[model samples]
Target: MKRLIAWISDLRLAIGLLILIAIASGLGTLVPQQESAELYHRVYDAQPWLGLLNGNAILRLQLDHVYSSSWFLGLLAWLGLSLILCSWRRQWPALQAALRWIDYSSPRQLSKLNLAETLSCSDASQELQRLEDLLSQRGWQVQPHPDRLAARRGASGRVGPLLVHAGLVVLMVGAAWGALAGQRLERFLAPGNELELVNRRGETQLTVALEGFGIERDPAGRPEQFRSQLRLQPGDPNAAVPLPASTETISVNHPLRFQGMTVYQADWALAAIQVQLGQSPILELPLQSFPQLGDQVWGIVLPTRPDGSNPVLLALSSEQGPVTAYSAEAEILGTLVPGGGPAEIAGIPLRIAGVVPASGLLLKRDPGVPLVYAGFAIALAGGALSLIATRQLWAIAEPKQHKLHVAGLCNRNLAAFSRELPALLTELQQG
Candidate 1:
């Protein structure tokens, strides 16, 4: 058991696991993952070799669905295990050493350490106390030993690896949670239409009503902006509360958020006509609602009598007379003739005027977003401190014959340290 633990705790194992994770995660971003049957078929049709990629064995192994595949999750699990084991074994000793008080006694031993400072001070204790005070003032906890002073500072270095590990765990957990549980829904609404967004599970819901939508354009007529006026309501249909009007409007690049859900302007599309039928005409009618192409609506208009015995209506010019139509439907419409045909337009009992194009909006809700944000914040802060803020110490003391010994150490930026150390030592000696 001890040998097994030791082998697993090796840095090589941890590094290998990390490399494997990076490779797998990179592949996740590179490949088009399993989405739907049609998308899979489309991909295979586009790249015929894609079918061979998932040989029957590989398909069952779930390589196509890499992100959520058991092997991928298992790789992540192994990564987590490797981090915990390696940190526990390697960092445990350094953490103990950093936490323990340093013993700074034995003048002879200190002199041999290449940093010994022999001071000409009549009051050694006072100078030592001052040094201790200075170090403490600079955020280092200090302790005095029998022959000399002992201090162990920056013990927090011990926590750096642990912090990074914790952040990785939190980040991974948050991302996995989001992948499994985050909800996204898209809706298209005209100027006055209302929409209710449903979650992936279809359990939770939210409603948004569009008050208006418009496009802004530059002086040259190219579109410069698009905007939407919306109302957000929370809770069930009956007990919902509407948000303030000022909060309802969202423009390009601006999004609306309410109850932890965000709504963004996605796209827009033109609206179409709706049609209905009534009980009594024997005549055949042409398509009343024409499909619009660009901004224009075009269609063929043919006319027939209600009894179907009349010839089709065609526009023809008479000799210097107004354009005449040679069908009974047009002639019938001239007089107050009654016909048994559709009572209303489309299936609705009313005629539809031109429609205002609808604007599509995307709504997204994620509960683990806060955790991911916190993890990123922690990683950034830790990384910045590790890269920028560093510890340094310069010591100078004069011994016999006006000779002074100076020693210095810096925790980071060694090149800067080397340049500054000589200047500091020279200044100390001259002073």
Candidate 2:
């Protein structure tokens, strides 16, 4: 068990784990994931090896969803466990050793130490008091040691390991939660389409109504801007309605939040529909015979008159289609019908109906947002604190000779400490 613990504490194992994490992160960036199996097949057609990772094996097991994978989760759990154990095994003993004080009887032992400074004083008590005061003034929290006036400070430094470990664990937990519980859904509308928010887990629990959509163009005739205005509503329309004043609007970058749901501006399309009114000979109505055509022009049939006459016909076509009369302007006498001119196309009426426009929307919901943010904040703080602050102080005293010694040490950025030690020693000497 001791050997096992020691092996786990080895820096090499930690480095290997780091390498694996790097590979996973690299794979996540290289491969497109979080999409359906068909999309994966499309993306990885050239790399047959990747085909093995498709379907439910990738999705259900979360290999494609790397951040949420069980293996990734297990890796994080192991990392946390290792960090806690290593801290207890290594830092705890080191900290205890630092806290322990020994009466220095021989100068040889004191000289063997790193950064030892011995000063002879007539009144050791007054010097010790002044030294304590100086250390306290310099932001060092002083504590007495066993043998003599061993002023230990910066005890909070011990928490650095725990802080880093906790931060990493929280960060991993937050990422996992987001991968499992957050979602993105897209809906298309012309100018008036509505939809509900869907989470990563494939659940829709909130709805949003699109109030308006705006489009803008640039000098080059490309789409420079797309904006959408939306209002949030309770998914259940029959429930006690919320105040109308509470409705919020959202656009592309600006997302509207309601009841833990968010609605974004995703995309849109135009739909062209034909309208018509009744009866003509099967040959007379080109549209009645064919519902959909390679050419999009459609003919509408309307209600017949009191007399046994042909009904109104409205032919509608998109910008792509060009309309032509069967005869020259002078010869085309009476294909024209009602609202404006003569009505004699087999005694029928004809007119153009206005075009209609529709709109599109996107929705999202993330229950783990707060957790993710908290984890990031903690990790960032730990990184900053670990780099800037560390603990190192030592003191030695003998009861017989009433002489005292003190020193400081650090594992990193030693040059800065070495430079600062002279000044620190000067302050101690003045006492």
Q: Which candidate ranks first by lDDT, i.e. highest?
A: 2
Candidate 2: which stretches are off by over 4 Å?
A: 1-10, 42-64, 69-81, 84-88, 91-109, 144-147, 197-205, 236-246, 266-360, 395-404, 428-431
Model 2 TM-score (2 dp) = 0.66
Candidate 1: segments with Cα more than 4 A from true spot? 1-35, 48-72, 111-130, 133-140, 151-158, 198-204, 215-225, 237-247, 271-356, 388-411, 414-431
* Per-prediction backbone clash count: 4, 16
Q: Give the per-residue lDDT of model 1 (tens digit) for 111-144.
A: 5542334545554444555666656775756565
Weakest 10 consecutive residues, lDDT, candidate 2? Answer: 319-328
| Residue lDDT tens for model 2, 1-431 | 99998887676776687788878877777665566788665544545435575444445555576766778767766765676677678867865765564444444565665667776766555666677777778887666545434444445555555566666667667667776777766666544556755545655546566667665556654445567666655544445764353456555577667667666655443333222323432222223212353243444444456763444434434212222122222233233322233233433433222233234565666777877778777767766656654546555555456666766666567777767766786877764
